[model samples]
Target: MPQGSSKKRERQYEHVKDSAKKRGASESRAKEIAARTVNKERARSGESKQASKTSTQDKKSASQRGGERSHSGSQGPTKDQLYAEAKKRNIEGRSSMNKQQLAKALGR
Candidate 1:
């Protein structure tokens, strides 16, 4: 037989709602996470009707902005660690450099 009407699905969905209410995750939060996941999947699919070039640029700029906040509120690397990475990478003139300077130099 064909799949039954959505009545069963709706009942199961109600159970899903009850279970979520019993737990701490709210339905709104679930929907927000789901929306973000769907957007990510759509980007990966590379089949959107919009201009691919524009979306590609948008993604690049958004990721660059994210990187700017990635290292905040943390101790970050130690001086010895910096020396080691600089040495490994053969980044010259690091003896007189600071961490931000080292990062910029090594980035190149």
Candidate 2:
């Protein structure tokens, strides 16, 4: 937590950090995520002395945006993830399927 942060920000940092860890982020990564989230929030609310352009101008708060951008890579969900879903659903001929076929089979 940053120096002189309010109790609310401190609690928010811990909550975000724990949530990140639960989602399989490493300890360091979790800390970084928490710090960034809290800092951005502080900047948004004008609690900090210095703020970045994007941080202050963002339309949505960190929690409000949620993970809208998560799992949206070059082609969205990875082939492995699609395959696993296909396997669970027992899609026909899934074993011989490529990434696109798996996605199509799984109706992604």
- Give the alpha carbon lDDT tens digit for every residue of 15-56 in model 2: 999999999999999999999999999999999999999799
Per-residue lDDT for 20-48 in model 1, tens only? 65677688765444444334434445533
In terms of lDDT, which candidate is strongest?
Answer: 2
Could you tell me how far off, in angstroms, the CA of residue 101 lies in candidate 1 after the best superposition? Answer: 0.9
TM-score (C-alpha, index-matched) for candidate 2: 0.59
State each model's CA lDDT, in order.
0.58, 0.90
What lDDT does model 2 reach? 0.90
In model 1, the Cα lDDT at residue 53 comes to 49
In model 2, which residue pairs have backbone atoms overlapping below 3 Å? none
Candidate 2 least-lDDT 10 residues: 67-76
Name the lDDT of candidate 1: 0.58
TM-score: which candidate is best? 2
